[model samples]
Target: MTGTTLTTADLDPHRRRILFRAWHRGIREMDLILGQFADTELKTLEGEELAEFERVLGEDDNDLFKWVSGEKPLPEHLKTPLFERILAFRPEEAFKPVV
Candidate 1:
């Protein structure tokens, strides 16, 4: 057989469903972040900055939990610049978070 390129629609039904669910979850997560940062607009960060913001936010389990839980304030390093970066991120420009 000749080489064939497979697109998302070419996936098996089960795989397609899984991908759809994953995409949905990602969108939901982005929505949650936006809601949490209601005062900020999301049209500022570029792709690379958003990637860095995600990386910093995801650094440690405790860090992620603390940021999400509001139990601990985000550190100045992460909060001042990184959080702003995240708040200004557009989901269309975000790459999927690495598992």
Candidate 2:
């Protein structure tokens, strides 16, 4: 199977939880942002990267959205290469929607 193809059950509990959290954020916009990132990138993250991702997930959704969208500067703790990677993510360029 392709790297992008994964069921939540196929992942370990930690990764599965992150994926679910990503897809179920209260705001639709944050859902799309983190959900796409989790789908395409979560399986590839290293231990430290996963830690960073989890920290990000623990944040308040609105603040996370603002940081990712550059409406507010990322706090020092949230400033990591992985966070930058997430901030830079763009699902529009990554996938072609069914028309």
Candidate 3:
């Protein structure tokens, strides 16, 4: 816990796991995608949405990326509104003009 601090200190165990996992999903793009999701929407997700997110996390990085990017058809079980929201999610810094 040496590097642990205020980031997830106040969160419950479940949220802490989700926050950590979202930011450390192996692939950097996936990390940023899910990490930003954790930062903004994770806290507000309903139980079913949270469950859907967990299912999304269970997917392989390449497949998830394809699904999120619409490069492949979404499997019926994975095509929830929450997944659609992930598809719509744009990182806050994405559209910023570099100085």
- Candidate 1 residue pairs that clash: none
What are the root-mean-square deviations of the candidates from the true structure over C-alphas? 12.5, 4.6, 4.4
Tens-digit lDDT track of model 3 for 26-80: 6666777777877778778778888878778878988876776668998998767
Worst 10 residues of 3 by lDDT: 1-10
Tens digit of per-residue lDDT, candidate 1, span 24-51? 3223454344323322332244476545
**TM-score of model 3 (CA atoms):** 0.78
Candidate order by TM-score, decreasing, is 2, 3, 1
Extract clashing residue pairs from model 2: none
Error of 3 at 60 (Å): 0.8
Ranking by lDDT: 2, 3, 1
Candidate whose TM-score is highest: 2
Instruction: Give stretches of model 2 more than 4 Å off.
Output: 1-5, 92-99
- Backbone clashes, each candidate: 0, 0, 0
